[model samples]
Target chain A: MSETAQRRGRGRRPAGEVREGVLRAAADLLLSEGIKAVTFDRVASAAGSSKMTLYKWWPSAGALAAEAYFAHSEHQLEFPDTGDIRADLTAQLRSFVRLLTHEGERTREGTGSVLAGLIGVAQTDPELSAAFSEHYSAPRRALAVAAFEKARDRGQLRAGIDLGILVDQLWGACYNRLLIPDAPLTEDYAVALVNNALDGAAAR
Target chain B: MSETAQRRGRGRRPAGEVREGVLRAAADLLLSEGIKAVTFDRVASAAGSSKMTLYKWWPSAGALAAEAYFAHSEHQLEFPDTGDIRADLTAQLRSFVRLLTHEGERTREGTGSVLAGLIGVAQTDPELSAAFSEHYSAPRRALAVAAFEKARDRGQLRAGIDLGILVDQLWGACYNRLLIPDAPLTEDYAVALVNNALDGAAAR
Candidate 1:
C-alpha cells in the first residue's frame, strides 16, 4: 500500500537477497579487478544495494574479501579419482599448477593488488585472519589430504611417508612458484613433483 | 668552510655510509615489524635520515626489503662434504631447519612472515621477483641441489633421480611447514624428507 510496498512490487528484493547480490558482486570484482578494487562502496553499487547493506553483512573489507576469495575458489578443488594413482596425481598436480599459475591469474593479480592489501589489514585483525585460514587455506588443505589418502589406499604411496608432509609438499611447490613468478611451473617441473614426492626417487 | 661543508657536518655524510645505515634500519624494521611495515618513511626515521636519502639509495620499499633480508642472511651456505651421505644430509638438514625455525620464537615469526609477505609481493613485481630468485630462492635451491649432487657423486643417490624435483621436494617440505602453522619442522621429519626422496617408500 505504501511506497515501500510499491517499490517491492516494482522488483525490489529482500535484505538477504541483497547480501547474496553484494557477495556475488564482490566475487566478480575479485576475479576481474582483484581484492583491492572490491570495496564496500563498489560492491554495493554493483549489486544495486547500499553501503549499509554491505556493512550489515561484513564487519570489514578484509572479511568481505576473504569471503569473496572463497566464493571464487569454492568449486575449484573437485579432484577426480582415476583408477591409477600416477595418472590421477599427474593430472591433479597439473591442475594445481594451472589453478595457481594460469587458471587463477586473477587471484594472482589480486594477491598483489587486493589480497595483499587485505592480508596487510588481516595481520592486525584476528577475525579476518581466522576467516582467511578457514575459508582459503583449510579447503585446499583438505583437498590435498584427500588426494594423498586416496593415493595411499591405492598402494601407490609408502606407509611411513607422512600424508601431511606430502600434502604440504604438493601445495608448497605451487605456492612457491606463484610467489616467485620467474620460476616457471612447467610441465616438466610438474612431472618431477609427482615423481619425486608421490612415486619417490633417488636423493641426488 | 663553505655552506656545503656546513651541511655535510650536520646531515650529509659519505653517500655509501648513509646508504648502509638506511639498509640496516630497513632490516631492523623488517625483522621487528614484518614486511608490510617497511616503508621509506619508517626506514628513514629509524636510520635518523631523510626520505630523500633513503629513496636515493633504494628505489622502492621492496628493493630495500630484499637487500636488507639478504644482508641479514649473507652467510654463505656451508655444504659439509662428509663421506657419509646420511650423516652429511642429517647435519645439513638440521642446520637448514635451525636457520629457518630457530632464531627465537621470533625466528619462525621472521622467516615465515617475511617469506609469505615477500612472495605475495613478488607475484606481480618482476624486478622484486627476480631479485628474490637470485638472492633468496637461488641460494636455498643451490644448497639442496648441491646436496643431491654430492649424493650422486658418492653413488648414494639413484641415477635416474631428478635433481629439480628433488630440490622441490626438500624445499617444499620445509615450506609446507611454514605455510601450515600447526605442524612442526622436526629433525626426524627432515631425515624422512631425505630418506623418502632418495628411496621412495610408496605403498607399492
Candidate 2:
C-alpha cells in the first residue's frame, strides 16, 4: 500500500480537472455507498482514471475520501464574521448542522455520514488522519479560531481565552454526536452549544 | 457471525465468575493488542472459555470489547458528589484524563488508545455502537447527569441547563482530543474544560 505512483498515461484533460473528477466520484461513492465502499479501483474506474493516478495523488482511501468530502461541502460550511461572535457562531454552526443532518434538503441525508466515516477510519489510518487534519479539520478549526480571535480583539469575547477549547466544546461536541449519536445533531443543539459555551452553565 | 450458544459445558466455577474472567481477558487483550486483536477465538482462548460460550453471549467482538472496556474502567471513572460541584467535577475529570493518558501510571499509556480504538470502530460496527451507548456511554452519562441534576437542585448550577451538552462540552471534548489528536488530552485541559464550561467564556 506504500507504493508511490507517478504520472504515466497521456492525459486528454488537464491533471487538475482529472483530480477534481476523481474527487467528485470518490465523494459520491462515499455518500451513496459508505466509507468501506471507497476503494482505489472503484474510485479510479468511476472517475475514468487509473489506479496509478489515485495512488500517486492520495496516500490512502481515507485520505482521498477526506479531501473529497472537503471538496464537496466547502462553501456550505464557511464561517461568518459580523463582529458579533454569538450571531456569527450560531449561523455557522446552524449551517454546519444542516449539512451534517441534512436538516432542510430533499436528499435523505447529507455529509454527516461521510464525515463520520472518514473520522472513524482515521483512528487507525495515519495517512487519513494527517489528511483529515490537513484538508478538513485543521482548516475548519482555523476559520472558527480566527473568528474567535477577531471577536476577542473586538471586545466581544473575553481576553486571553483558550480558543482551542472553544472549538472542542462547539464543533467537537457536534462531532461527538455524529459518532456517539445518543443525541441529535440539530440546529437547536448547535445554537444551545454556542449559548452555553459563551454564557457559563453555573449561576451568575 | 451471529451464532447463539447456551450454557452447554459441565461444572465450571459459575456463570458469573466465568463471564467476569472473559471480560477481564478481553479488556487485557484490547489494552495490550489494540481493537483488531480482540477476535472471538483469541478472547475465548485467552479467558479459557469456549468460542461457543462467547458467540452465545455477545453479539459481536465489538460488543464483547465494549463490555470488557466498561468492566475494567467502571470503578476508576465514577463521578463524585461532595456538595462542591467544581471540585467534584475537577477531581473526576482529572482521574479520567489520567486513566486515558496513563498520566499517573508507570504502565505505559493507559485506556486512551483503547477508548479511542473503541470509538473509531463503533462508527462502523453497529453492535459496538449499541453496546457503547448501552453499557458504557449511557451509564457513564447517567452518572454525570445525575450529578448535574443534584447540583441544579441545590442551586449550584443554572436551572434547566442541558446536562447532555455539559457532558458533550466536557467529556466529549476529551473524546474529541483522543480521536482528533490535534491537542494533548492532559488533566489541565480537562480542568480548563470544566472551568470554562461552568464559568462561561464571555466577559461580564
Candidate 3:
C-alpha cells in the first residue's frame, strides 16, 4: 500500500519537503523514543510520507538516525570565532552542554541517552559508526581544531602544541562527565575547564 | 526444578564459588555474545548453577552485567603511586587505552562494545547507572583524585588547580576517543595529552 503511494507523486510531497519531513520525524523519534524507535516505517508515517521515500534516501535506520542526529546538532551547535579563543571555546562548550542537558521545546532531555544508544549501535555497525563520525564528530572537531590553529597563528597558543590533544582535553572532559553522570556540565565547570587547560596545571 | 536445585545445597557449589562462577560466566557471555545474552538464567546455567542462586546475588541482568564488567576491570586497572605524576599518569593512560582497545588473553577486543552497551543501558536504567558509577567509576576517580591531591601537596602540581577538573581533563580525552571511533588511543597520543594538560595549551 505504501509502495503504491510512493509511486504516485511520492506521497504528494515535494522531494525536498519529503526529505526534510523524514529527517525531522527521525530526529523527533530518536530524541523521544531512542534509536530503536526510529524505524523507516515509523519515520515515514510520522513524516506523513511513505517507507519508500525513507528507504530511497537512507539505506538503513542507522543511516536515518545518523542523519537526523547530525541535522539536529548542526543546527544547535555553532563554533564561534570571537577572536578570544578562551571565550569562544567556553561559549561553545556551554552551548554544547546546554544542547546535551537542556529540555526545551525543540531539544529533548534524553540527548545523552540518544547519543549513548547511537554509540552502542555504532559499536556493532561499522557503516553507522563511519557515517556518525564523518557527519557528526568530524565537522565539530574540525571547527575546534581550526579555531585552535587560528589561535596558534595569532601567537595565542603555545608553540609545538598538538591541537588534536588540546581539542580532546577540552571536549573529552565533557564527554566523560556525560558518560559517567557523576558531574553536571555546568557553566562554571566549562569556565574552569577552559581556564585549567589554558593555564598550566604545573606549579609556576 | 531450578528452585528445587537451589534449595538443595545452592546448586552444589559453595557460596563464594557460585558467585565467582556466575560473574565469570556473565563476563564471558557479555564479552562473547554482548549484553543481551547475560540473562540470569543463561548465566546460571552457564556457571552450572541455578536461577535462584543467581537471583540471590544480582537483582537484575543489568546488575549482573555491571558486576561482571566491574570484576573484570578491577583486576586490570590499578592507580599506582609511582611518585612521578607525569610518568604515572602517562602509564595509567596507556594501560587504560590498552584495556579499552587491545585484544589479549583475559581482555578482548569487544571491551569498548561492552562498555558502550552498558552506557546505553545506564541511560534508561537509573539503578544500573548508579550501580555502574558507584561500583566502577567513583572508586577509579577517587584513586586518581587522591594521586592528584598528593601531587599538589608535594608541590608537583600547580597551586589553586582543581584536581577534579585536572583528573577530568586527563581521563576525559581518552573516554571521548573511546566513544568516538575516529581516533585511536595511541600511547604517544596519551603521553602528549598528559604533557599538554599539565603545560597548558596557551602560549607559554
Per-model i-RMS: 3.6, 0.8, 1.8
Q: What fnat does each of the candidate structures reach?
A: 0.49, 0.74, 0.77
- Cα lDDT, all candidates: 0.68, 0.85, 0.78
User: lDDT score, residue B199, model 2?
Assistant: 90
| lDDT value for model 1 | 0.68
Kindly state the number of residue pairs that clash in model 1. 7
Instruction: Sort the candidates on TM-score, descending order.
Output: 2, 3, 1
Task: List candidate 2 segments past 4 Å from native.
Answer: A1-17, A74-77, A103-107, B1-18, B48-50, B103-107
Q: Ranking under lDDT, best-scoring first? A: 2, 3, 1
Put down candidate 2 lDDT per residue, A87-111, tens digits, no spaces: 9999988888887887223224676
lDDT of 3 by residue, B150-183 (tens): 9888888987877888778887788778778667
TM-scores of all predicted structures: 0.83, 0.88, 0.87
TM-score of chain B of each: 0.83, 0.86, 0.85
lDDT of 2 by residue, B34-144 (tens): 888899999999999999999999999999999898788533547888999999999998888888887223225677777888888898899999999998888888889
Could you tell me the TM-score of chain B in model 1?
0.83
Candidate 3 residue-pair clash tally: 0
- Between prediction 1 and prediction 3, the one with superior lDDT is 3
**Model 3 quality (TM-score):** 0.87
Write the residue-wise lDDT of candidate 3 on A67-168 in tens digits: 888887534547888798888988988877766677756556636667767766675566667878888788878888889999989888987878988777
DockQ of 1: 0.44
DockQ of each: 0.44, 0.72, 0.65
